[model samples]
Every structure is written in structure tokens, then in C-alpha cells.
Target: MDKKEELKRRQADIEAMGGPSRVERQHQMGKWSARERIQYLLDANTFEEIGAHVTHRGTRFGMDAVQAPADGVVTGFGRIEGRPVYIFAQDFTVLGGSLGEMHAAKIQRVQDLALKSGVPIIGLNDSGGARIQEGVDALNGYGEIFKRNTWASGVIPQITVIMGPSAGGAVYSPALTDVIIMVRHTAQMFITGPQVIQAVTGETVSAEDLGGADTHLKRSGVAHLAVDSDAEALDGVRRVLSFLPQNWMEEPPVVKSRDPLERIDETLARVVPDDANKPYDVAGIIGSILDEGDFFPLQKGYADNLVVGLGRIGGHPVGIVANQPRVLAGTLDINASDKLARFVRFADAFNIPIVTLVDTPGYLPGTSQEYGGIIRHGAKVLYAYAEATVPKVTLILRKAYGGAYLAMCSRSLGADLVLAWPTAEIAVMGPDGAANIIFRREIEGSDNPAETKAAKAEEYRQQFANPYVAAGHGYIDAVIEPEKTRGHLAQALMALYNKQDHRPKRHHGNIPV
Candidate 1:
């Protein structure tokens, strides 16, 4: 046979991909094959594959009888929109997308290229963990990938998409990435499976309950974005890249916006109800103020009381952190504090401006919060705000009570400008608690004790429950109309476009983890 014809025959065998039936079954399971996913994720005709003929070196345990095309992985470079991104997609059709020495080498090559090129890298994980036939070499392959993930952190953004199982040591690579996107029913990530858990710990659990997308996104905060399908997850990755820069040294990408910055939104006035006790979605407020109603919320399922996301302000990327009164009254808790601190530090690291919307009642108070080291954890938010040199603009939307106010970028925390809505109440605490402490004796001595306490509480509210109190003392820069919030923020962000922040001499301050 001719050499060229032999090459064509092998290529056709590899493209058949364990035959069409397996690929169809994979589709029936609601996920695409490795090559199909990469094709779907990258722009049309943009992909330039690096490794397609590499096969496994394993010969033990009947591995010698199999032909593992691409060693269960497809590595290449592609464009998301017009920007370059390197990707390594594992093909589950071949040996369960198992990792051997060559497969790991292929991934490492793309990662190395991404680092040298200073472009983002995306990993589409769908594997049954390491190939057992390769033994320690398989283990070493995982170790190499982990090393690359750690070394690439904060340099080139690493994004992981879980389209299928990521079990055992395989889950750690996604954990090391800056952002993780997972599909609802098809993806799972955990150290051990339910069968192993039952054998080891006598606890029986389903796979989805143990490490599913909802489990990670809502309960554990392990994954950042969870969606209904692989297509949406891929889109999520592209959207995230659109906001972030390829590297830390450069400013985040500034997309052109046609949304009118000066347009006043009266709908914001209704999002925050006149009834202080009624809860409303903070995302509505964020939507009213951001450009084109675009708010890419981080951890939407976790620590919802504190909303963190990236959005554009007058075509410039900015990080938005706000309080959601709908959950636990928007009280600062351990998870909420950690979430905000991490987001704040990330935005600061990448040179993104911070715009904070404060409406918290205060830090959550209870034996559980204190026992959970709320004091230590809550300090993280304070430390992040005080240390950040990026342009910070804060607006007290309603209530900013106690130290939580300072924790949320108060004027004293080096905020470039601190604006407050007319409805804002920047006080040490809410009126009920303040009145009970200050007028206790007077209320107790009155013939109608309940009536007297209510009167005192009302008196306290009238005295200290408005933004004018904070503005009078220069704690707030200005009190603006609710409709003018978008305009004011655009101008404030514009004025601080070239802000320069200098820090005292130090290698790096140790933040309490």
C-alpha cells in the first residue's frame, strides 16, 4: 500500500471515534464528543489543532489491543470572537477519555503555549480520571497538569468547563482555575464517588447530590457558573473572557457600548420599596444602573446576599458588589464576606474599578455566626477594601449600619467618592436596637411600656435614619436622586479613570485566609 493511502486510512479510523454509535449515545446523554465541544466553543474555521495523531503508550492490561486516537484528548488554539484562546478537550469516547502520559503531554503543550503567548486557556474536562493501565505515569501526568495550573494562576486566566465527570484528583485542576463553569445534569466533580463514600464512610449519596452543578454552585461555592447545557457553559466562558484581560498586567477589555450613560432610569425607584421591611432583588438595581442591563454575576447561587459581578460603565469594565436584602436581610455572614473579599481582590489585581452598592442591615449576629469565626472572616472584607488601590466608588442605597458600612468601602476606606441615595440611612445600627439600648430606663418606667418604646424607636428613626446625617458630617460626598444614579456613577468612574494608587514598602501583606 502507498504511504499516503495508509495515512488517509488511519485518519479515517480516528475520525470515526469508536464508531458512530458511541458518539450518538454521548449525544443521547446530553453532551457532545471532545472534538464536537471544541468545535462548538471556538469560532468557525478558527481552530488550528496541535495534536490529533498522538496515541497512548500503555501495553499492559489489554491496553496494547486498543488504538487511542489523540490519547483521548484534543489540544489546539482557537479564537473566541476575535481573541485567541488555547484549549484541551478530553474525548470520553476513547478509553473513557482516560489520561495516559501522551494525553497529559498534549494538554501541557497547549498550556505552555498559552502562557508564552499570554492568552487565556480553557479546559473541557470529561474523564473517568487517570488511566489505570499506565500506573504511576498516569499519576505523574495529573501532577504535571496541576503544576501548570498553579504556575499559570493570575498570569493567563484559566477557565474550566465540566461537561462530564471530573472525579478523584481530576477535580483539583478545575479547582485551581480562576473560574469554573459546569453543566447542570451532565457534570460532576468530587474526590470520591457515592459507591466509595458508602464503602468508606457508610454514607450513601447520589452523584448529583454529591458533586453536581447545583451542589457546587449553591452549597459548596466550588463552581462559579452553572447552566442548563454545554452550549450555555461555553457561552459563559466566552462572556467571562470578554470582561477579563488576557493577562494581569494589562487593563480589562473595554467593549464599545451604545447604551446611553446619561439616561435616567425611574424603574430603580421601585426596585427598592418604600417599605424598608420588604425585600426586593438587588439585580434589578444593578440592571438599572449598568450599561445595557448587562451584569455577569459571580456565584449567583452562593452567598446571594452579597452580589458580585463584572459589568461595563460607559464602555469601561467595572466590578459591582452589592447587598441583596432578599436573603437573610442582606446581613454580612462568613460566606458572604469571603465571597465579596475574593471578588474584590480579583478585581483589584486585574486593575478593574470597584463600584459598591451598600444596603446591608449589618453583620449577621448570632451564636452561629460568632462560632463560625465571623470576626476573623468579616475582617477579610475590611482588609480587601482598605488595601485596594483601584478606583472605588460606593453608594449607600438604603441602610449602611455599623462596621459593615466601613467593610463595604466607606469613605474612610480610601473610596474615591462615596455617594448615597436620599433614602439611605448610615447609622451605627437600626433604630430598634439603638432605641432599646439608649431609652431603656425611660421605656421601662412608663405606664405604657410598649407604647413608650415604639415612640422612642420612631424618634431615633427620624433623627438618624437618613443620608442627610452622613452627608452633614462629610461621610458621604453627595445625596443624589434615585433616577440619577446611572449618570452620577458614569461621571464618577470617568473622573477617576487615571487614578494612581501608591502603597508603602512591603513584599506583600499577609491577608487572613
Candidate 2:
């Protein structure tokens, strides 16, 4: 064949991707092929594939006859919103999208290039774990990829989308990534398959029940986002990338938003009910302040008590952490603590300013929480907020009592500015609790103990439970109207935009994991 014809033949063979039959099977399963997914995620004609001609080197058990196009993976650089990113998609049609020596190498190359290029890296995972035919070489491939994932952490943004089965060692890579997006009904991730579990423990469970998207999102807190279909999952990735910068050294891309910075939602003034015990939806408050009410929440189903996600204030991307009073009285628990700490750290690493909304009564009190090491877990929130050098603006919406007050990015925890509404109660503890402890003897001796206790509680609230008490001590920088929260936050974030805080020179402080 002539040289030009030979090039066309090689290109056609690679594009075939495990023949037309498997491609059709993939479509029937409601999952896009590897190339198609990359195409859908990136801009039109922007993908520059890196390793398309690479083939596997497996020679055991008649492996020499196998033709694993691109070694079951496609690696390349692409543009998401005109910003550079490196990606690798496992071609499920080729060799079950198994990660052999060459497949892992292709992924590693992209990872290295992403780190070197100072851009984000995305992994479209759809594999059946390590290739058993390749044995230790396959395992070694996973080890190398995992090491790079660790090294790249906090340096560049890493996102993983589980489009198919990720079993055994394959699940670790996604777990290590900054955010994990999974497709419902089509994707599953587990350390062990159901057959193995049945053989060992005899607890029968379907794969969907064991590690489905809902299972991970709501139960295990493994997945950050879960979607209905492959297309939605890819779109979810694009949305996440919009909030992040190219790397840790850069600021998140800002869009010129039409949402006015001075715009105030009058309903916010009445958001907090007069009865402090009554619960309200914090999402309403979050929506009222963010630009166009666009808040991209992560791990929404897992930690319902504490909301953490990305949004924009005056078109500048900001990480939002809020306490949901509707759930567990917005108390911090083990899971919520982990969720808050991880999101704060991620935001800090990517130079995204943090905006915290506080309303938590305190840490959840129970034997389950204490036994689960809530002390250790809660310390993570303190450590993360203290360690972060990014611009931190905290708004005390209602309840900010006890250590939970300090944990929610208080001025003591290095927050650059702290704002509060007149309804905010910033105190060591709730008035009722403090009153009971302080007036115990007086209440016990009074004719009507309940009335005396209530009167003393009211007195305590009048003395120290209001925002002016904290504002008097200068802990709160300003006490603005609830309706003006968006304006205050937008102005504070802009003023602190060039914020520079330095940590002590050291290797790194060990965060309480």
C-alpha cells in the first residue's frame, strides 16, 4: 500500500474501536463509547488524542491474538470552555475497558502532561478492574496511576466520572479524585463483587444495591454527584469545571454576570422565623445570595445537614458552606464534618474564596457521634478553616453557638471578614442551655421553676445571645440587614480578592483525617 493509503488504513482501524458490534452493544446499554464521551465533554474539534496507536503487550493465555485498540483507553488534551484539560476515557468496547500495562501507561502519560501543563485532569472510568491476563503488570499499572493521583492532589484539579463498573483496585482512583460523578443504573463501584460477598458472608445483594450511584451518593458518601444518563453525567463534569480554575496557582475563571451585586432579596429579611426552634430551608437563603441562584452542590444526599458546593458572587466563583437547620438542627456530625472539611480544603487549594453561612446549634450530641469519634472528626473542620489561606468571608445567619460557631470559619479561624444579621445569635451556647446551668440553684428554689427558668433564659438571651455582643468584641465585622447579605458578601469578596495569608514555613501540618 502507498504511504498515504497506509495512514488511512491505520486511522480507520483505530476509529473502528473493537468493531461495530461492540459499539452497538455499548449504545444499547445506554452508555456512550469512549471517544463519544470525550467528544461530548470537550468543545467541538478541540480534542487532540495522544495515544491512539498504542496496543497491549499481553502474551499470556493466548493474549497475543487479541487486538485491544488503544489498549482499551484513549488519552488526550481537550478544551473545556476554552480552558485546557487532560483526559482519559476507557473504551469499554475494547477488552472490557480493562486496564493492562499499556492502558495504564496511556492514562499516566495524560496525568503527567496535565500536571506539567498546570491544568485539570479528568478520568472517564469504565473498567472491570485490573486485567487478570496481565497479572502483576496490571496491578503495577494501577499503583503507578494511584501514586500520580496522590502527587497531583492539591496541585491540580482531578475529576473522575464512573460510567461503568469499577471494581477491586479500580475504585481507588476515583475515590482519590477531588470530585466523583457517577451515572445512575449504569455505573457501579465496589471493592468486591456480589459473588465474592455471597461466597464469604452469604449476604446476597445486587450490584446496583451494593454500589450504585444512589448507594454511593446517599449512603457511603462516595460519589459527589449522580445523574440519570451518560449525557447528564458529562454535562455535570462541564458544570463543575466552570467553577474551578485551571490549577491551584490560578484564580477561578470569572464570568461577567448580569446579576447585580447591589441586588437585595427583601424576603431574606424574614427568612429566619420568629420562633427560633422552627426549621427553615437553607437553600432558599443560598439561592437568594448567589448569582442567578446558581449553586452547584456536591454530595447533596450524603450530608444533608451541611451544604457545601461552588457558586458565584458577582460572577467570581466562591465555595459555599452552609448549615441546613432543617436537618438535625443543622448540627455538625461526623459525616458533615468530613464533608465540610474536604470541600473547604478543595476550595482553598484552587484559590476559590470561601463564603460560609452559619446556623448550626452545635455538634450532634449522642453516643453514636461520640463513639464514632466526633471529636476527631470535628477537629478536621477547625483544622481546615484555620489552615486555609484563601479569602474567607463568614455570615452568621441565625444560630452560631458553641464550638460549632468557631468551626464555621469564625474570625478566630482566620476568616478575613465576618458578617451577621440582626437575628444572629453568636454565643458560647444557646440561651436555654446556659441559663439552666447558671441559674440552676435559683430555678430549683423558685415557686415556679419553669417560669423562672424561662425568665432567666430570656434574660440570658437579652444579655449575650445577640449579634451586637459578638460585634462589640469585634469578632463580627459588620451586622447588616439580612436582605443586604448578597451585597455584603460580594463587596467583602472583592475587597479580599487580592488577599495574601502565609502559613508557617514547614513541610505540612498533618490534618486530622
Candidate 3:
């Protein structure tokens, strides 16, 4: 064939592969084609695909017969909300979107581009693991992607959306990501498929039962957000990027508004319960205090016991972390610790000031928790909070006990401002637990054990457990009413907005307990 004729034949082949029949087959499976998904995800007419015309090497049998654009993984850079982001969308129709040598190279090239450009990465994962035809080359391909993921950690935001089946090694990329969004019906993530488990242990379990959104969000705490459809999942990705910067070096974009800081929500005055054990929604308090309807919560489902979100206190974007006493008695556990550690690191890396609302009895204590590596995970929270160099302000709403108090950005962590509500209990432990540990002899000697215990608990509450003791020792900066929290935090963040940390000429510290 002549040069012009050969080029025309290649063009025809590409178009035929993207013809209506093939594209419609993908649509019938309730998925968009690789190109179609990218188009929908990016700004209109803005995508400039990388490696758009690259093809497989000639040695592989039937490789030339297979027609694919960008090797079934459409990768490129695009704009969302006028900020640049890198994206990759897998085409499940092409050999189950399996990773071949060229396919892996396409993804790795885009990942390297994202890292060098310092733009956020969005991975639309819908693969059936590695390609068997390529054998070990496919495995190496996944390894390279993981290496990029490790290098990009904390440097830029990495987002993964599981739009369909993602099992085995495919799940690790999403697991390493900063945020994972999964579709309810079509998306599933698991370390091993049911067939593998059945082969090993003779246990028959469906994929949905083993790794669905319901299992991850409520049970395993893996998925950050769960949506009803692919459209909603993509929209969630856009919404999440709206709050973050193009890279960690820049500040998040500000939205203009003229809301006064001192405007108090009447609900805040009554939100805290008089009794310590009663549970009230901290998110409601957060909503009442933040700019109206601006609280964008991250990881809402994974760690319902703790709340993390981004919002403007006084026209300035800030990170808000709070405890929810309504769930699991507002106790910090292994999962909650991991959740908070991730949030603190993200905020510090991006220069967003952190605002923590502390209301926890203590870290959860049980045999199961100890075995689950709670100590190791809890240490991560402590290390993250301690190592953070950004401006931190904490508010004690009700309970702050023992190591949990220190973990929640207490005085020792260099919290710029620490405020406490009148009901705040800053203690080594709760009164009941304290009495049991410290007044055992007094209670054993007393004729009425119950009354003796109650009296001792009240004495501890009055003498050592209230916020005043911490204030006296200069641990707490001030005690304020719940109504004044918004103004206080707004003023605090504004003052410290320009604060910068200049470390000594050394590498980063070991993030230890």
C-alpha cells in the first residue's frame, strides 16, 4: 500500500472501531465508552488526549487485529471549575478494560505527567484485573501505577471512582488514593473475587455481599462516598475538586461573600445537652456555625463517628474536624483514628487551617480493638496532629479525656487557640472510670458502695475534671459559649492565615506515636 493509502486505511480502522455498533454495546452494558466517559467528565471540548495514536508492538499474536484508541484507557488533562486536572477512564468493552503492556504504559505516562504538573488525578477504574495474554508484563504495569501513586501521595490529590467491578490488585490503587467514590449498583471493590474465596474455603458469597458500597461504607469503612449512579459519582468528583487547589503549593480558591462572623445561630446555644451521656449531632452544630450551606463534608460515610469537611468561617476556606458522640458513644477507635490522620495530613499539606471540635470520652478499649492494631493506628492520629505545621484551633464541646484530648490537637500539639464550652469536661478520664480507678479503696471501705462511688465521681468532676483546671494551667486558651464559637474561630483563622513554618535544615521527622 502507498503511504497515503496506508494512512487512510488506519483512519478507517480507528473510526470503525469507534463505530455505533461497538459504542452502543458499551452503552447497553450501562457504561460509557472510554472516550465518551472522558468527554462527559471533562469540560466541553477541552480534552487533549496523550498517546492518542499509539499502538501495540508487532510481536504479539492478534495484536494488530485488535483495534483500540489510546489502548482502551483514555488519558488526558482537562479543566474542572477552570482548574486543571488529569484524568484516565478505562473502557470495559475492550477486553474487559484489562491492562496490557501498552495500556499500562499509557496510564503510567499520564500519571507521571500529573505528578510533574502537580495537578489532581482522577482515575475511573472499571477493569477486570490484569490482562492474562500479557502475563507478567501486566503485573509490572500495575506495579508502575502503584509507584506513581506512592510518589504522588500528599503532593496532589488523587481521586478514584469505581464505576464497575474492581477486584484484586485493581483495588489497591483506589485504596492508596485520598478519596474513593463508588457507585452503588454498578461499582464493587474487593481484594479477591468470590470464586477465589470459594476455591480456598468452600464459601459461596456474591460480589455485592462481599464488596459492595453498603459493605464498605457502613461496615468496612473503605469507600469515602457512595452514589446512586455513574453520573452522580462523576458529579461528586467535580464537587470535591471544587474545594481543593490545583496543587498543594497554592491556596484553595475563595468565594466572595460578606457574611458577618458574629452572627450567632440561636440553635447553637441549645445544641449541647446538659447531660454528658446524651448524644447530639455535632454536624448540626457545624452547619449552624459555618457560612450558610457551605459545609462540604469529606468522608461522610466512612467515619460517621467523626466528621471532616471544608467550609468558610469568614470568607476563608478552612478544614473542620469534629467528633460525633451519637455514633459509638463518640469514642475514637482504630477506624476513626485512621480517618482523622488522613484528614490532618491533607489539610496540612494544602495549607488549610484545621478546626477540631473535640467531644470524645476516650479511645475505645476492648480486646478486639487491641488486636485490630488500635495502638498503631491511634499513634498515626497523634503523629499527624503533632507534626502538622498549619494553623490549628480546637474547641472542646463536651468531653476530652486522656490521650484522646492530646490526639485532637490539644495544647501540646501547638494548637494556636483552644476554646471550651462551659459543659466541656477536660479530664484524664470520665468521672465514673476515674472513680473506679482512683477511689477503689474509699468505695470498698464505705458501707454504701453505690453512694460512695457517686460522691467520689462528683468530687472528681468538681475538683479536677472541669475546663477551669486546664484553663488555670494555661492548657486552654479561653472558655467561650457555644454561640461565640463561629466568631472566635473566624477571627482566629483570619489572624493565623498568614502563618508559615520554617523548619530547620533537615528532612521530615519520623511520624511516630
TM-score of each candidate structure, all chains considered together? 0.94, 0.99, 0.93
Best by lDDT: 2
* Overall lDDT per candidate, in order of appearance: 0.91, 0.94, 0.84
Ranking the candidates on lDDT from highest down gives 2, 1, 3
RMSD score of candidate 2 (Å):
0.8
Ranking by TM-score: 2, 1, 3
Lowest-sum lDDT 10-residue window in model 3: 10-19
Backbone collisions counted per model: 0, 0, 0
Residue by residue across 1-513, what tens digits does model 2's lDDT show?
899999899988888897899999999999999999999999999999988999999899999999888899989998999998999999999989999999999999999999988999999999978899999999999999999999999999999999999999999988889999999999999999999999999999999999999999999999999999989999999999999988888889999999999997999999999889999999999999999999999999998999999999888999999999999999999999999999999999999999999999999999999999999999999999999999999999999998999999999999999999999999999999999999999999999999999999999999987899899999999999998889989999999999899989998899988
Residue 240's lDDT in candidate 3 = 77
Quote the lDDT for 12 in model 3.
64
| TM-score, candidate number 3 | 0.93
The residue pairs in collision within model 3 are none
Winning candidate number (TM-score): 2
- Give stretches of model 3 more than 4 Å off: 1-19, 502-509
Query: Per-residue lDDT tens digits of candidate 1, residues 47-156?
Result: 99887888888889998998887788889999998899999999888888888899999999998999889899999999989999999999999999999998888788
